[model samples]
Target chain A: MDVETLALVQQLYGAQSHYIDEGHAREWAATFTPDGEFHSPSYPAPVAGTEALTKFAADFARQDGVTRHVLTNVHVTPAAGGLTVRAYLQIVRTLPGGPPELLRQTTITDDLVRHAGTWRIRRRTVRRDDMKENR
Target chain B: MDVETLALVQQLYGAQSHYIDEGHAREWAATFTPDGEFHSPSYPAPVAGTEALTKFAADFARQDGVTRHVLTNVHVTPAAGGLTVRAYLQIVRTLPGGPPELLRQTTITDDLVRHAGTWRIRRRTVRRDDMKENR
Candidate 1:
């Protein structure tokens, strides 16, 4: 029954990892719903809507240094209006000839909804492992 | 159709985190098959079989500190004779009055098989985020 759902979920993660890691921010943002929310400790507040997401992706692409965001351990559970997905994310940053540094380790939880037979993230909350203050 | 399979995978991770964090070394080892193998950069070689796994867990449980092994982002895919599961793991350690420190961030991959109506890990691999040497 949920075989297809799980596959769809896999696609979501696959596309997300590929696009973001490869610096296709708009394409990565497109994996979310039009009004999807991306929240993290680095941000002052959640970035919402396609317009904001576009700008957010642009800013991310402008950051200095090479980064690879590795997403793993994706667990998806059916929810009332959609599905809840949780996974662990690690970002590695590197300079020329230098070993990769651990930039951030975060747990990401996403609320996904199937709209028009396509699964899209509705909200993504990122919780950093080394957060100093509670929000 | 695969809902239960994924849930069982989630259970494997949940049980692993709980048992290891709470110091139930033997119980944690039971999550693996009789001939299961656990490998990590920290280990000189793969810890093979239940006996070795038991000893490894025992030594881990003796470490001093309040530690939490937080597992997230679990992706489970069907494979020959079993399932391949991957996720991100973060270990947090805290001393009294000190901030929770990120001790380790690793990407874990486990090969699990269903035996006699139960799922058990066959081979588990750990890759750390900030390893200076490649193995």
Candidate 2:
């Protein structure tokens, strides 16, 4: 993708993370297309479509801590259907009366499609980094 | 700043992280101007100038593990002398035979200058998050 498109993709990420982090579940889910799919090792099963996506995000938001999704090192490529995006995702958390901590680091690969003049995720797969220890 | 300039600033972060992560200390130091300054809670003293910056990066490279600087949520503002850039800095590290983990998270603010047609850091200050726990 070109630089202008790259800038738009970056904004897509910023908006997605902001919505979820701020507990705006519906808005967060809207970051995806109507039939978007999410497949991640962190979840028990893949979630697809608007209703399911909303619930998935809402469940995470109901948790007892604040979580931030930090996306960096984004690389984008053009595809037949949309654009392929790969980025480093660092999840940071802070629980009640607890100090902020780095919860986990994962790589997120996404297929982003622009529908109705806006970019949204069509599919996303998150992979955890291989490590000798979990902590 | 405009979209194009924003794209350039993003490239600056990517290059800065890549050079240091790959152990190219001199090249990493060159990401800054000749009299650039770096201040961070992670370091005992502020380091300035090309010589000191190179040494600072080299010292970190001497460590046993591999470290990656993940920068996200970058914000840039135009200033009189240069551009003020701020971003979330997540430090992730992995030792030999150890799992990769998030070492720390901090906020980084930078003063960027265009010297000889390329962007370079004039000053960078990193601040740690207020955390009750440092693990």
**Top DockQ model:** 2
Candidate 2 wrong stretches, greater than 4 Å: A1-4, A130-135, B11-67, B72-90, B94-135
- In candidate 2, the residue pairs with backbone N, CA or C atoms under 3 Å apart (3 or more residues apart, or in different chains) clash, namely none
lDDT of 1 at A133: 61
Give the lDDT of residue B33 in candidate 1: 94
B1-135 per-residue lDDT for model 2 (tens digits): 776777777767755775676578999899899999998877778899999999988888887666778887888999988799989888888664546677788888899999978789999988888644321
- Scoring each candidate complex against the real one, what DockQ results? 0.09, 0.23
lDDT of 2 at B28: 88
Interface RMSD of 2: 3.5
Question: Where does candidate 2 chain A have its weakest 10-residue lDDT segment?
Answer: A126-135
For A1-135, candidate 2 gives per-residue lDDT tens digits of: 367787788788868888988889899899999999998876788999999999988888888788898778775767888888767777888998999876666667789888989788999988665432321
